[model samples]
Target: MLIFPAVKASSRLPATSNNLHPEKHKDLYAVTEQVIARAIPLWNLSLTPVRLPLVSNRIKFKCPEYDMYLEDMSDSEGPRREDAKMSTNEKSAEKNGSATCRTSSNRNLGILSLVSVPPHLEDQYPIEGPRELKPDNTVDIWREYEEDGLQIIAKLANIHLTPEKPEYEGGTWHVEGQLHICASAIYNYDSDNLTTSRVAFRQQSNVQRAELKMSYPQGDHDFLEEVFGCEQGGSGVQDLVTVDNPEGRLLTWPNILQHQVQPFNLVDSSKSGHRKIPALFLVV
Candidate 1:
């Protein structure tokens, strides 16, 4: 439902300078524009956007910074009066209970010995039965998000590997974390003189599924590597699959999985190598 610019790279272009080479900058921008035009379609193919109702995108909700809402409640005086009445009732009950406990003999010592539980803090908002959420009957988060739309955060990175530093150490395992990132599209548009690099996806899996299919000694739950293909301690992370990040390859996956780039070296160690990538992360 949101109509905006296709991409903001054009808006984010650096300003021209008098000392800058104008012709070279012109060609650079021309190429970048063309690449972006081509990449938009691939981004469309990357993931299907789901309309999720997130707390950040909630409409027209606010909190008064200086107890202004409390001031408004004071003007109404209804809830305050009720609270005053309830406190008086609690004091009266406590006094009566103390009087009865003092008058009791050794035969009623059992009742006196019983601990008195404090009144629940939620007595102010008491309700019949459970006034909590029922799992079977759920409330829809997206009640009326008609004007909402998916948000995208874009990233562009250029990496050059020279002969002295031919091997890329790769990236650590992580998830994209801007505004509830749900999907990602990584397009490595250009690679030269580099070996094939890959991105591996991994996540915590349900070990109980495999546990139910087999019989084992009670409390002997050391099947982390045997069943889930991962070890215990720091060496183990459950892997699902890996996708190649070669030149002009567009790889996409949901952000539910943690991802990391695998190590790669130069195809020709004598020469330099590089890769240019533009990634788009989708948020809901």
Candidate 2:
């Protein structure tokens, strides 16, 4: 009979701390800052700064002209003072151009002049275009795949998105976030050849979340309905031609991915069957 009494569970349990989950507790600012830092160095290497020669700073001057005046004091008796004055006035009028007195500051002096760049300096620094990610550029990932018709190029650019607020209120709710994606493509349109040569700057975004809460206004939801229910058809041709009614277009990630594959596939198929495809290209 030495059995201990069964421990009764307490009605009230001790409250656990409301600490944030590790996965859920993301520092968005820190994440964004890291993304920027990683992105900037890659961009800087791609674009070289254009330099201009400095000009010399100098002062200029201008001068004014005046007529010479002579007084006839000794011969004042014959001609009188009035005649002398008249002569003086006549001489002053005969002067062709007024003399201009100019100081050094009056003349315009260019700040700097272009001088011959020293041979040593020229050798050290040469005129160049933007730093390009050459086919032979030494990037760990890029190099391995470059010859295999795969490439990655990145640049820095600004992006803007619509729907200022996070919530969907009156109008059709559209979620948008903008970011610049610097891209390089390895594909040829003509014979469907594959090689990395094309570079582009794109403004792209993702709609992470969307919801329709309430509707008091009639026209508020119209745009949303239209966006959600739009049909995918082009000039003159439809996927289903005979059908009077066309299916509404649905915006999804798969559709976007499918649209991007054509160009890539064209080049990929044309490449020599023997060449080894890089793992990164396969993942992308």
Candidate 3:
């Protein structure tokens, strides 16, 4: 594990100030430089800190930039050009004059094809999976998170936090649409093997609440990584990134990217060791 030193946000010089001279803020500059030097290891990462009411209790690991350890909050900027690798079925179709490549559609995903888009329905679960998909009905609890959560994400990401669908179509935008809340009970060790990896809308599920979610400490199995070779830094995995799911941190990303949680060994072996996370899917 790579250990990165913590940097305080206050150490940095404020973006807006009347004083133009560096000498005026020399002390602030010195502290800012020191903090940045310590945080050098995280230079390649995009870090955003958010506090949800339920996760920000007196106890538990609480760090402002905890989201840095996780990845995939931003969308791919442009379409990637890849050499076409025809699958057996695709090759057969090509020979029979039934195949026509649509590079435009696949370029954004850096893959051959995408899964069927899930239908949009209010307060209803995604038809493709057996999981809870509820509305943002609990306004009191969610209201606290609105400004700090999606609003901050929107500002940082330069996305509109609109509830309606975005106008851009055909993979132009990765994160889009109004925010949706999904709550579900995580699987125990027995049912862990049965869980399927999926996105929020089969298209955009950014910012999933990952509190008390534990992964197997020691395991030789990662089906998505081993079988599909979908691990970060692997082939055909350029567009997607990996984030370590530390407790109380939120994982944000575009919905089009394929993601999966590796099955992990339970830290504690008891009925009390189950994990549940309420995911907040939105356009920011």
Candidate 4:
């Protein structure tokens, strides 16, 4: 069994005053979309949750320039200090202890600092895994079989990309989409002598809230073989299973505003210039 831990989001670019220009904002959204797209493959393979640590309650966003300041809160002090000492060695020890405390405090605070992004964006970056299975003689029918089974589970996890708010003509935009993903896969092998089964559970936040809804749930022991692009009992099963599957799932946004845009004609002079757009835009 193998275990891959979650990777935290680390890149933080200082917010420039002019970063909110229409073109720049569009670019930011595009980059965000790309990140979501790229992350799908990774999510599918790991069978773990993707947690984007960009959002925090302590940070607030102000337009024009995104200023991030730490919240003002008092720190608690422990019990009173021990007796004072004037010895040379004691003084040196105190100085070293203070320095170490400061260093540790700085490190912990740095980790707590949150990265700020446009309010219209949201993401769930997935954690990766090939989590190790326990050793048991009854279940070790084929070492390669167990390995291959895990590889397929990871691959399925990588293909999904959660939707985000779409870019529009106006400066204001809202992200109101919710993504719910769940994957459960099991591998079982049974014969006259021994029987074994390995199960994996991968679930994501489900944002759908309505009376009627549709969902996709797919799983099979054979899916592992299909992901490896091999047939059952084929060669290289062990090596292929051990390899990580990094591709995530993909999703397509519906064309919800198709009729809103007027058709353009080459010969029509009245349609050449841009028209006044409406204030309220709704996507359902």
**Reference-based lDDT, residue 88, model 2:** 43
Writing each residue's lDDT as its tens digit, candidate 2 over 78-196 gives 32223222234334544643221211221121111122333245443332322233434432333332334222221222111223321212122111211222222122112212222
Q: What overall lDDT, based on C-alpha atoms, would model 2 receive against the true structure? A: 0.23
| Model 4 stretches astray by more than 4 angstroms | 1-100, 103-176, 179-284
Q: Estimate each model's TM-score.
A: 0.48, 0.16, 0.21, 0.14
lDDT of 3: 0.29
Task: Estimate, for each residue in 76-120, the C-alpha lDDT of model 3 and write its tens digit.
Answer: 544333444555754674588552332222322322222222224
Error of 2 at 62 (Å): 27
> Candidate 4, residues 47-81: lDDT per residue as tens digits?
22112123221222211111122233224522222
Q: Lowest-scoring 10 consecutive residues by lDDT in candidate 2?
A: 273-282
- Report clashes for each candidate as comma-separated counts: 0, 26, 4, 30
lDDT of 1 at 11: 18
Best by TM-score: 1
Tell me the lDDT of candidate 4: 0.24
* 1 versus 3: better lDDT goes to: 1
lDDT per residue (tens digit) for residues 1-284 in model 1: 11123342221223343333557667654544454445444444333222221211212111101111222345344332222222354357457753211211111111112211123523632332233333333322122122352345556788899989989999999988765776777788788998897999887656566455444334443333444565544444577788888887777776767899998989999999998887766556
Q: Which is better, 3 or 4, measured by lDDT? A: 3
User: lDDT order of candidates, best first?
Assistant: 1, 3, 4, 2
